[model samples]
Target: MTVAPHPALSANLATPTQAPAQRDDAPIELSTLRLPTPPVPPDTCVIDVAQLFLDANYAGLLSLPIVAADGAPVGMISRYELMRVFLQPYGRELFGRRPISVLMNHAPLVLSVETSIGDAARAIAQHIRSPITDDFVLVENGRYVGTALVLDVLRAVEGRLADRSTELERAYVRLKSSQAQLVQSEKMASLGQMVAGLVHEINTPLGYVRNNVEMTRGVLADASQLIVAQQAALDALLGGDVVADAQARLDEVETLRLRVDPAALDDTAALLDDTLHGVGQIGDLVINLKDFSRLDQAGAQKADLNHLVASALKIANHILRKRGIEVVHQPGELPPVECAPAQINQVLLNLLTNAAQAIEHERGRIVVATRAVEGRAMVLIQDNGKGIAAENQARIFDPFFTTKPVGEGTGMGLAISRQIIEQHGGAIRMTSSVGQGTRFVVVLPLRAVVREAA
Candidate 1:
């Protein structure tokens, strides 16, 4: 195949960038950047150079290659030097009859097709004996294939650099945006888990509060009737003899006691205490949720794994209680972990909620345990629910892979959980057998190095 010179070659050859033509194996090869080689037969005359130039259709080209009979580059000839020689007195007559090889550069700049532009430019710059305008021969497998100009290589490098800069800028913008979205996604998922248990948790205490208030109202009414009875007795005493009405008043008081029910009044203090305790329980859930969904605390910090589990449990209690699932916490003494507390809380909550949702029947039991092992903190959450099938277990961590009915799950819980845990220098894995149970083990380092952005 005959390769032609670029149409803009003439314009660029005059003011080429000061780049060398040293050969190198880089990503961008000279083969893709080289122009067609301007060649002449070994026997071609110096006077025939004009016809050679016209044949190649590169009038502005300053250098041309002299090829041997076998098409190997023998040397190069420069238009500037050629014109100088011909301008001498009888110079054309003296040399025009001889082959161009007599005056051609025998050791011109040469580069391989595989040469990288940087190395090529460096090589060209190092060849101080040769002019910058000299076109370097591009050879492949020891045969002349094409030629390259420094200007073309520099232009290619500049364009490539510009494209790379744009690409990096786009990637950076996407990273920042994704980080923001990830934080919001975690918050929403945490909120969703908390909301699942919210109705039952709030209703339980609210029901008790209503019952206690009703009972207290009845107690107040009974007390009011007793006060009226005592007042009537006082009126009788003030208007008549005290001793006479004392016995009657005492009888009325006895009747009033019967109506008031002394046992009920005795229980008032305990009933109020129970109501107060119920309200406090509801309040605790709210606070736990608030701490669990700490979206603003995105930075890493020292945290206790046990406390994170406890907070997650509190947030997921409504789900556990609703399903009659018993949670047994067996926490071992552990050191604090350096991580993002809120994200860790989010991970724990996801595991607990998933355990609750996996239960197909009542009496489901979830066991959450934490321990320190080999300078690492491990959290084990096991559930005696309908365990995952072997085929489906592997895909549970994949995004949008959920067994829940439509709209009941976004399938992002485990996926996001894994991301958060891994970002904290931790790992989460699960083991399950269908109809038996499922166990999730999360291992985290006590002190974690901050993760770099992808």
Candidate 2:
């Protein structure tokens, strides 16, 4: 007949062990969490261990682990216990002759290197040994490796949880934003598709009309030369014609000449030239719009920063012109930066638009410059407009934080620009004085470094 086990022991035996709950996102493990091995005296060593404690004090160790032969952890000894033993009268004389293992916990908790932080934490919580303040010994395949404090494990796990939570929240926000953008894009695509066809229809005819206008201009030039020659001949033949038919023909020709006004012809040519220039500008604007809006053009390659800046400047030329903002471009010698060109162009254009908008004066000044120093490329955009107030400068790059009136700003320009620059291993900085001017500096690495969201 088997004797019945004690009630508590029976309960413990009946309870099926459940694995510790672990989040899928937890990044901490025993191997990474364990502190470096602390001072471990051989289990056979005498309790001159008090001296070991003194030595440990100098070395800044909190505790010591007693290891047996073959480097297997036998037990751990804490500084407090050792100090208590030595503080007693003649305690060293009585105990110093014995092996340090006498004072160490023979049944110390052990953890394997592959244990998850969650499992280790569970083990720590369930431990019922006396002097629970002792650090846990970390081992790999029964060989002593290191020690872990309960505090370190808890802190690491907590930090990991916080980071994972933050990441999920950010991802959720991005997902919602992306969904909205996709819906808006679909509508825009439908509109653009139909408009593109109309544009093609109009452009095809407009192109030929321009060609014909050019040809007409050439023909008119030739006609002007012929008319001049005819007038010279008419002057020579005046009052000298003998045949009545020839005289009448010459008179008719003279009448036609009188009807051709030189000034009017000049005006017509000027109008054609102006029309052609306007058509060209429209074509360019369409191209820039496509470049700005195309979401599928995210290919990275070696690109000239100055060329990207110029393209952006060209796109924003009209805004500058309207305000009479004078742009001073100093394209410094720079190396090619590996980046997605169109995205960088958009960032530059956004900065330029902000620069143009900041100015309240007719003689606004914008200085755009590029330079390479210390293996990094830099772009500087400075504007002398009603500058950004000092108080508002910090939040200028925050999304939806704008100084402009309600409909005039969505406040995402600088925010998006900074994001794009940072994605390419770069940074955007700003300096401004309320009445003087504002300057934006974009710094980018020549070589891109891959980064994960913090």
Question: Best candidate per lDDT, number?
Answer: 1
- Local accuracy by lDDT, each model: 0.79, 0.71
lDDT of 1 by residue, 243-311 (tens): 867778868877987889777988998999999999998898778877877766668788888888888
Local lDDT at 198 for model 2: 41
Clashing pairs in 2: none
Instruction: Name the lDDT of candidate 2.
Output: 0.71
Candidate 2: worst-modelled 10 consecutive residues by lDDT: 1-10
TM-score of each: 0.69, 0.52
Q: Write the per-residue lDDT of candidate 2 for residues 1-454, one digit (tens) a residue.
A: 1222233223322433333455665545787755554335554444655566566332444566666546577787777777787789997777777777777777878898678887888898888345555768777788766667777778877877788789999999998688456434433533353245345544654776687677667657656765875775576577566566556666766775666666757666766776777677667766766765665656677889998888778667766776789999999999999887766876787788788889998789999999998999999999998888778878998867888787556676677678778988999999998878999999989986624321
* lDDT: worst 10-residue window of model 1: 1-10
Off by over 4 Å in 1: 1-62, 65-97, 101-148, 235-258, 361-363, 389-394, 452-454
